[model samples]
Target chain A: MKIDKSLLTGSTTMLILKLLEQSDMYGYQMIEELEKRSQNVFTLKAGTLYPILHTLEQEGRIESYTKEIPSKRPRKYYMITKNGRKLLDEKKAEWQFYATAVNQVLGGEGYVGV
Target chain B: MSECNLLVKEFLNITCEEIKAKRVHKQIVNELSDHIEEQTQYYIKQGFDELTATKKALEQMGNPTIVGKELNKAHQPKTEWSIIVLTFTLVIIGGFIQYFVSRANSYNSHAFFRFLIYAPIGLIAFFCAYFFDYTIIKIYSKLLYSALFISTIIGFVFINRINGTYLYVYYSAILFIPIFAGIVYSLREKGYFGIILCGILYGGVAILCLFSVRTIAFLLLSISCLAILTFAINKGYFKCNKRIGLSIIYTPIFLILILSVYYILSAGHRRERFATMFNPENDPMGAGYLSLLIRELVGNSQPFGLSQLKGSLANMKAELILPAYNTDFILTFVFARFGYIFGVIIIALFIVFLARIFTSVLKQKNKFGVLISFSACLAITIQFALYTLSNLGIIATFSVTLPFISYGGLGFITNMLLIGIVLSVYRNSNIIMESL
Candidate 1:
């Protein structure tokens, strides 16, 4: 099922931080990985991803570095900072709590019977 | 292949055109073009032709204008308004102080008019530095350093001295501090060799200071240069082991410190100055005279009102009036005339000015900006501290100007220019990329 575009907006930062938390990534790698991991439900545009990445970088949540890859152009990679990891944890808890609350409000398993 | 390259270049140009920060356009374009090329490779692997795949990648990256606009928003050139505002406030305060101090001493009245002229000239110099592209320093680091070094040596020998001090000569040499920062930036990739090169350059300044007998300028320049070098080393800009880098930088300074201490102890006049530094009563009418006078003046000063000392600075024969009241001892004059609170207000303003400069310095991402701004901050702050400490009799009295507040001269203009460079670094903080 296609996720609503608006539904993904607020979580994009959390997702990007979460992705960087696992390993440092360049822009294109992060986008492709996000799409594959989300089963193609979260195909982020390069336009959208870079702006968010740059903003996180400015906030010191993430930092960018240029790494030379063998036989290829130097790539600018973004790594999650300590602040970014702490923020990701907080975001994860908030997401869990939010999802649980929304499920409960919609009656969840109780609504399954209904 | 060529067709595909043209297509990618056009997309990059359109996208870069949208971003207003022209400095970061290359970096952002490099990054975006990499993304497009990667996407095109992926599509080609999935069976699309090079041109077709390039078109597909560009389409998926979304609209060029929107991407550029967003990138532009993220990379706008930053201006530090707080610094600009504080500098103006300090300059005006300095103007008022100079006016009043001149009014009190007719012999020094020309200083007020000079202040009128130098203050605007200094402000023009400040803005000129603020608007200048500091990258020019990076590009011309060695050339600037060599030219300034040679000229300073020439100035030392040829320039006429006023009252036994090389006023403009040493003042011009102070410009070496920031230019050395550029030199350090240019030498970053050379590892330990870079540190040694920097040490050699700094040794030149130290030797110049020693030969010219400008102890205070030497002390100020050395400490400021050491701070800049240490900061760069600690930031790992030199790409060498931090411990070794620090040791390489400090060993010479440590040796110099010991040697200078030994030299001061051995030199008859310097030994007398040193001994009197601790107990001014020993030489009440000679080397210790100024220290004792400062103590007497400050000791009797009231917090809210001027001191009761009655002597005309214009006459130069009074027991109470300090020498160079308009230049080096302006703070003491302010305390004597305007009260301690007013003096504290000036010091507090400097503290804020320094604090603001440092805060801006910390926000810099570009290493070149960091070096230039940090060195400027240290240079200015050191002069301000040394002058204030000297006025309060905590340190030996020397010929150091109180940055903006001192009667306007070459030192004041240099300080203004340094502040301008710092502001320029802050102004380009966001737009410039960190060097790899």
Candidate 2:
């Protein structure tokens, strides 16, 4: 199966942004949520996921806070920034357009040459 | 719930402080434990026994260190400003000790003159290093290489017009120019192979231009370059066989060049100095005088030494010794005057001085910082060691000057430039910290 290395990161970022849009979560919860939401179709490796969180934090697209949970360790929880919400909306629109264009071709219809 | 969880939690707590990020540790522990628990629960739900499920979950967790390290890499905090300030303070203190205290007792007009001439050169080298962006230096490696080549050639051609010995005049810049350029280019280029090539080329030319006047200085310079080359190779910046082959090729070529130059510049007294070094009795009053005096001072100071400036050996009543007491063999002079206690103190100070520089180098996180700082430290430390060893008769007298303490323009300026390079590394480390 061919994989676009470039798309992997952007998709992971969008997935993270979308997930955090629901509620703030730590790294493990984020990974679990992504897996559960996608029915294991997207297994976000810890290595790939943390850098995206850090990059988002650095970009001010997300903000993180730490809270101690009883019977478990303290976790750094990431929440989407206003800027992050804005970016997520724009990315959703762009991805919708891209998915439709690709699906049109994959759906067995010949390209209406433009 | 799993064996791996217990082991990983223990390991993570123990190593977390070393990870450089407080936030990362919390994130990693939480994430890893949750994942392990989830895996164990998943396996148990699939009808495995509890222990068996835990074993499977633990196995599927992969290496905790690999996972922990990836997390650490992603969120490692920029080095704190306190660390940078502490490093800079230590380096400046080291430089001050080397300059002032190390050479205090040996004050003289010649020493002052040497300082005056070389200090400006050192300051220029320092500023050049201080203000120049290391990235720009690396990006224009070829340009720096060409500049070094052209300058060396220009100095060589103009050697005859200079006041000093032809060789000394021609190659004085060899000490700092190539080293500075090498470091800058290496840092910018992401490897020191280019710097090593430039060093070898410059060193090869120095050997070609060698004469009796600066043979020892040239040898010391070449050895310093080789030390840096060795360090670069050890750090994996250059491939092993390539570096080894280059050294092997350079050595024989250097020897041949030196032999030819020696033949051209060989004067009666210069040849006699070489002969007398082997057997000082051959011309005790002539070329052998300095070596004999050095041996006598060091020998007399054994177990413990005579009082400072009090050794009759250094006084040399009616004996032919070098006219100046401290120019070349200041170590011996210091030992004779201050006794073995002072000698040990001086050696200890030099070791401490080198140790501090090395500490700063090791603390640096970036590759360029490590290489440049380490190279400069190695150069100074080896020179100091060789000078001390030769003075104590542990090696042949190579006419090497004690760094910073020695009274020579070239030696002094080169020493300052080295100090400057180290400081530049510290400064850049601060900038990196601030950026983070």
Candidate 3:
């Protein structure tokens, strides 16, 4: 499925922060992991991912450090900051509220009552 | 596979071409290259042919220009806004002062409008310098140094000597400091050859200033060079004892030679300036007249100042009193009209502005940025101090524009340009810190 950029735009940083909450990951690893977890519902271009990563790093919500993997290459690994974790929790709550509103408007009140 | 490698380089090159930070470029290139290599290997191990693996890896990385633009957005050099906003404020206030002072005179509205034009032009000059890529100095250090050198020598023919002071042309000499710093930094690996070449270029300018009558330029240039060398030493550029010792020996000796020449050239009114600085009585009617009156007026003007009196600012101007009040003696207009509080506020802002400059310099990881920023900061600080002291009748020898505050032409532009370079350095400096 082709995911519109707008669909991912608002929550991309949140997704990144949540993924990073599990373990520190480099660019290629995060891209692959997101593809696997989402079951290919979202195919993020590498171009789109970097600016979001950079902006997150600049905002102090994430920090990157280069580590050399043996027989491979030096890769920049990013980890979520304490602030990023707090932000992720808030974003999660907001997403839940947003999802509920949309579901109700779309006649899915059956699940809500149950 | 070789073709694939070329493809990787070309893609990364296009992706990062817009990004100017040396460290960021290398970092991104390495990251992208490694990812491509891994992807290529993965495809090959999956039974794809080498050509197919390479092609697939390149395709998956995405479009170069789009990626480059995205990366550029992140890496866009941040202009130091506090300085920009503060400088703009000061320029506006300076325009106000000029307008009010000019309007104070009954018939003359000329200076008021002239200042209106100069303010915007000065700001544009600043932005131009700020927006210009500062790395050009590093990339073409030798070329920049050579161009500034030729200009300084050529500067002599166009000296704008007004009221017994050579103020023009030599202002270009200030450009020498940063360009030379860029040289030393770029050629730092070349060891003694670089240091000697740097010294020779500096010595040439210092020597020119030594013989010329532009004492302000001579003083500003020498002091700025001292600041750059000190910063380089502190930043570990001259880590070896030999370089440090050589600079120590060469710098003071060079300064002494300049000082001796200045002393020798300090004949006529120049020598009289030093002789009458403390005791205005010695040459009270001669060179000491203006300084003596300045001291008396400032002393009598209390907390608020002479402008508190009816039409005193206009009165001072219309009566054709206080020679050159708009030019060399500009601070008198500020203090006499606005009062001591305003004068001190102006001084405080200068200090704050300088602090902003130094703080930015401290953040620069690269030695070239640090050195160039330091040179500019030192030049402005020294000029500000000397100009303030001279305005207060402490030292009559130093006559310079009070940076963005005072009114002048080329001198003001040069100072603004220097500030712009500092801004450029600051704008480009943030991305190099690496964690162990």
- Cα error, residue B235 of model 2, in Å, equals 4.5
Candidate 2 C-alpha lDDT tens digits along B219-262: 65566556655555555554345556456546765888899668
Global local distance difference test of model 2: 0.60
Considering only N, C-alpha and C atoms within 3 Å, which residue pairs clash in candidate 3?
Answer: none
lDDT, candidate 3, A3-90, per-residue tens: 6879887887778888999999988778778888999876666667777887677666788887877886668899988978888999
Compared with the true structure, what per-residue lDDT tens digits does model 3 show for residues B1-436? Answer: 4876787888888887877565688877877787777778889999999879988877887888888887777776677888888777777777777787677775446767877777677778888988787778878988877787777666667755466544563566667767767876775655556566666777777777665667677777777776665556555565445556467547766788899769856777666656687677788777777777677555545466564333344445312566556656667667776677777787788788888888987766555777778877877788788878877777673557677777676666887888999988888655543432
List pairs with backbone clashes in candidate 1: none
Native contact fraction per model: 0.78, 0.17, 0.69
> Which is the leading candidate under lDDT?
1
On residues B1-436, what C-alpha lDDT tens digit does candidate 1 reach at each position?
5988998888889888888778888888789888998999999999999889999999989898898888888877678888888888888888997787667768777778899889888988898999889889889999998898898888877887667666665685579899999999999979999999998988887787777778788888888888988888998999999999999978877897899899999889889878898888889889888988887676656786667554443323222468888788878777776678888898998899899999998888778988898888988899989999988878778888788878757888899899999999888876777843
Error (Å) of candidate 3 at residue B314 is 15
Q: What is candidate 3's CA lDDT for residue B428? A: 69
Measured over the true interface residues after superposition, the C-alpha RMSD of each candidate is 1.7, 5.5, 1.9
Assess each model's interface with DockQ, reporting 2 decimals per model: 0.67, 0.09, 0.42
CAPRI quality of model 3: acceptable
